[model samples]
Target chain A: MVTEQQDYAYNSKIEGEVVVSKADAVINWVRSHSVWPMPMGLACCAIELMGVGASKFDIARFGMEVMRFSPRQSDCMIVAGTVTYKMAQAVRRVYDQMAEPKWVVAMGACASTGGMYRSYATLQGVDRILPVDIYVSGCPPRPEALLDGMMRLQDKIKNEKSLYQMKKGREDPDHLPTGPR
Target chain B: MNFEEIFSELKRKEAKDCDSFICEGKDLVNTLEALKAKGYEMLIDLTAIDHGVEASPRFSTIYHLLSLGEKNYLRISVDCEAREEPVVPSVVEVFPAAEWHEREAFDMFGIKFENHPDMRRILMWDEYEHFPLRKDFPLAGIESEYPEQDVVERTDLKVKAAPMAGGPFVADTAGPMSQTEPMAKDQSWTESKPKKEA
Candidate 1:
């Protein structure tokens, strides 16, 4: 019976040495694939976000079905509706409370650009309040569109270099770029 | 009780609907109390309409009261004088549900509900300065003066012109050089001219 270390050595021989592989790549790979999303369902788009979590769309397939309501427990936030002026401050507070290396997906036209409610009460876009990693278009985008957006966020997380820097104590996770591009 | 009996008991002038009445602003609270005593238990809705800036008695707070047992409805229109601050007595004592509706009316039209226990902006944020539904308030929103300004007017924002004059269903009568007089007798559809041999 081969030991676990021997098995890793044998497997690494077929590719590259396991010890020589980039730690950032390994960590990012694991973090990107297992993003726990906080469902911030504000309005109509929330219904579609629910659809993606349900059996039909099965967001669990991508390992993001853990819908945490608390900001502290969530790794990503899916802002799923119109962020009105009344809700902007709350959205910001939630964003601030989320743990570091977090991502925000603005999921729908309203969350991305306040959709048709260009009025006194509605915030033009969630980006005005919180930093957004991905924007899913559509007036309440279909479940598939939300899944696609989540995948895009996963890709962004995979490409992030700051996570490695923070782990190495060379960068401040709290000061990570939370600003709009 | 029937609407007639209630009207006579309340001593309110019966309008055309026989259920609605234009109540004096000062007597609004008492009128609501009397109606509540007469079994108009549910305050269905409380809303205000802002007649344009030029209209007299610029605001009207309309209350829709329903009597479940009697199967009747009453509409009370209370005229709120146009001023820097418009005040109308709160009817929360008569019907507890008026709290939210009155707050909404206050939020939209700036109609002050005097003696409200916890009067504050319900729909808008606490810091929201303007009453949105007022005719004077800009429809899009006012530009913010805060340090982190939220509302930035988009230069690219364009409002599309109406597809047709008046609307799609209405005939275009305002176009330049358009005929305004009735058609000539020969132009009528019934008259037929001889077809030229081709």
Candidate 2:
């Protein structure tokens, strides 16, 4: 729920009127909720990622159920597998292609640090190539864990200073991360 | 999948009667030529084994052949007598499928297949130098660079070795048995440890 102010007093009325709030708060809330994820399922860990999207776990609650294959459409890159050396270039290219105000989630142990494969082929961590905002641990992280990560990302997005907020001469407040819930 | 059991069964039933034999490296082309003349017309698989980097005959090129008409199987083991850079004659001219197989073998074990049309690496990138399957190649890998980063070149995109931290292998031996067995104190391949300049 948005914080109440003099401009937002109409929202409290019966049959609630127009809500007024900072552009940062509104845009961040929208961006956080409807984070269309670019699913980069490279290995076995991707199975767990799929479970998050499916009805059993239901990623729809967080509004990230749209697993966009194309990088252009998606705002979040959930790299859900082992990033091998051969695939590193492709991953980087995809990350670069994605539109700005994008976030990356290194899902599962492999995507975080190569997991059991301490080998020549696998890239040590996806962060070695992509700028990761969140890292979900576990061999294949449970769907709940992924949801938790999504919420954490949402919290991060909520705290970020949007362009409109910056243009309004309002500097980003150095506030400790507050949970969206 | 149970090779020992299958081999034992084959041995009991006289495997030689099936016409599966291990041939020398020099005789590979001749053996394939003769096998093709017979009903064993298909080259099913071609792979290589690394004996050791130092051994006299360090590499062995293995070929599996199959015949639909005769319902027969032939496996040939061609031994190459060389320690470094073992060379085996490519059977691609006779069996077309051997081309990729030979390239894969070269890519993994550094075994050169003579007279193959394209002898470049089949799996790893063209610039990748290491024969990963070689005994000397470490599991944690070697530090290397990726030169193809053209999009956003902010930091130097290098392929760093995985931080093994020597877990499960290197244990804290100074502690009591109970403590030492459960947790590992890094001895080698640690992030905190100072890296040697290349």
Candidate 3:
């Protein structure tokens, strides 16, 4: 079969002919592979976030080394600590500015559900302000847990209706609530 | 001079606690001036305590002074005379650093520091209605919309009071001693009082 160029009846190699994939597959593949993260490192969990980016853990293996400070530049917002009532407005303002097709990773107990800080000053959870895609547990999760959450987020992205639907969902975010899933 | 010499110079009797001495509201400025001459250089901290709304001399403005030069400390306690609208003389003229401390005392205990350059609440915003540190204030905070009129105009940023959610919970008995010894213990509150289980 390898020697049969004239026969066309069948080599495993399709030399010069095009290979096809769904638009969903290609775009999601590209987007999932190169996720630019906005690190909202407000407290102790921020140390662990830095650890993920450091050489020992090497977040670059997933092609996510670029940590964008600006909300517009990043695709993922990793809220890594406590969200106080005073700070919720600022967080919402940044979330509003983040580009469409954005995803949020609520890292650690504090960012997810106020952890032990259930008080008047602390916002019970960040979901009070922004929609979260993944909730990674741990008081301050080890770097491995965050990486696993990232991969889970990637898996979620790969399964989306993709492209047009995501944009339409953003426009009518209320109607098509990107609620938990 | 040591605590004994300083007290003797000020014509004060020995306090039960040698480092601290009590003074009247009218004599606050005079005592502070005399202590400054005695070389207690810094007004380290000033705070006020509310004995009770009903108690005579309802507030006590406590000052912690340090002589950075002498390497010693002195505490001066002065009672605000009026029970209802307590006012104490400001010491900013003598210490300059007492400005913010006086503001903090006023903010927390409602003990007005008379002749303070700017008499406003230091911790709570200008429009905040309640003195949070008062005994009557609830453990769970009060709910209000934006504190500033300008902030209301700018955005619909609502800072809601934290929900109790059957929370500020009684001791989660399973947890270790470090976590749950002192739960939100009081039964009554001046604000949103927690409902009884029954």
Steric overlap count per candidate: 0, 0, 0
Candidate 1 chain A: worst-modelled 10 consecutive residues by lDDT: A172-181
How does candidate 3 fare on TM-score? Answer: 0.72
lDDT of 1 by residue, B32-124 (tens): 888888788899899998887888889989999998888988888888875647899999888889999999988888889998988998988
DockQ of each model against the real complex?
A: 0.14, 0.36, 0.23
In model 1, which residue pairs have backbone atoms overlapping below 3 Å?
none
Q: Residue by residue across A67-142, what tens digits does model 2's lDDT show?
A: 8999999989999998888888898888877876789999988899776667778877887667789999877888
- State the weakest 10-residue window (summed lDDT) of model 3 chain A: A172-181
Candidate 1: segments with Cα more than 4 A from true spot: A1-20, A162-164, A167-174, B1-18, B146-198
In model 1, the Cα lDDT at residue A116 comes to: 61
Give a tens-digit lDDT track for model 1, residues A1-181.
Answer: 9756534335655776646667678878888889999888999999998899999999989998899999999989899998876676677768778987789999998899766665667767787666788999887898989898889888888887854568754544445655443
* Model 2, span B1-198: residue lDDT tens: 222343332221236544555566666787687768766799989888887767657788878888888787777777788767789999999999888899999999889999999999977878988898888887667887775756226435676776666545444668577575422356555656754555
Clashes of 2: 0
- Indicate which candidate wins on DockQ: 2
Ranking by DockQ: 2, 3, 1
Whichever of 1 and 3 has more TM-score, that candidate is: 1
Candidate 2 segments exceeding 4 Å error: A1-16, A164-181, B1-20, B36-44, B66-74, B93-96, B149-152, B163-187, B195-198
